[model samples]
Target: MKAFRLEELEAQRAANQGAYLQFLRERNMSVGLYALDAGQADPQQPHGQDEVYFVVSGRASVTVGDETETVARGSVVYVPAGVVHRFHHITEDLKVLVVFSPPES
Candidate 1:
């Protein structure tokens, strides 16, 4: 069995960005805690794999194609493969938990 603490993961680097913390990864899945500074925009594009985003704190304006959703703490977003999505307008220091399936290569 393996256990992880969010505080520990906060010290690691994932994409050279300042707003994301990857807490765990195993098999083809991963869990990441994200910290979005105010005015930050989460990059968007098509992915070969599907992913889920769960809001842990603050608010986010998420866009998936022509549709947009306002997410807050305790909210969740599910993104399918090949869909274009992004998180934006991080008014507060947004914290999000993301899970990826069939991990990217």
Candidate 2:
């Protein structure tokens, strides 16, 4: 089995210097790390594949479609494909795990 370390992914993300850093890609799904600084804006647009987000740390509010909700560590959210979604009003540095089914195109 393949093993992944968070510290390693964090290092990779720092090197990439991107809001999202993809770590794994398979035919069925893709996994990535998403980070947003406090008071930062998420610039992502709607995706074609269904997605799942798991908050790894910090606090923020996510708007999915027309609904918005607060999220923090241990929070999990599901967003259907073609839905508008983004995180805003970040009260603290946000770290999230993102999964895209059928892999992201």
Candidate 3:
């Protein structure tokens, strides 16, 4: 079995601008770790695949479509494919575990 440590992943360079470390890619799914500094803007846009974000640490306001919610450690957020989503107003450094179904190409 393959395993990963979030601390190690966090130390790697971010592939998606704001420190995104893609650690796994299976036949049906992909997983990654994303980190954003407290005052940094989230440059993400609509994704092509369905996704789930598990908040690993920190706090922020996540916007999915027209709805917005505050999320913290242990919180989970879901986003449908091709929908508008982003995180803003971060109160602390944010660490998120990201999963994409059908694997992101």
| Clashes (N, CA, C under 3 Å) per candidate | 0, 0, 2
lDDT of 3 at 6: 76
Ranking by lDDT: 2, 3, 1
**Ranking of models by TM-score:** 2, 3, 1
Q: Write the per-residue lDDT of candidate 2 for residues 1-105, one digit (tens) a residue.
A: 767888899889989989889999998999999999999999989999999999999999999999999999999999999999999999999999999997999
Question: Which digits, one per residue and each the tens of the lDDT, describe model 1 over residues 34-102?
Answer: 777779767657777788988878887998777999999889889998898888887887778888887
Tell me which of candidates 1 and 2 scores higher on TM-score: 2
Which model scores highest in TM-score? Answer: 2
Number of the top lDDT candidate: 2
Provide the overall lDDT of each model, using Cα atoms, as 2-decimal numbers. 0.77, 0.95, 0.91
Backbone steric clashes in candidate 1, count:
0
Candidate 2 residue runs with Cα over 4 Å from true position: none
Better of 1 and 3 by TM-score: 3
Candidate 1 global TM-score: 0.82
Residue 50 lDDT in model 2? 98
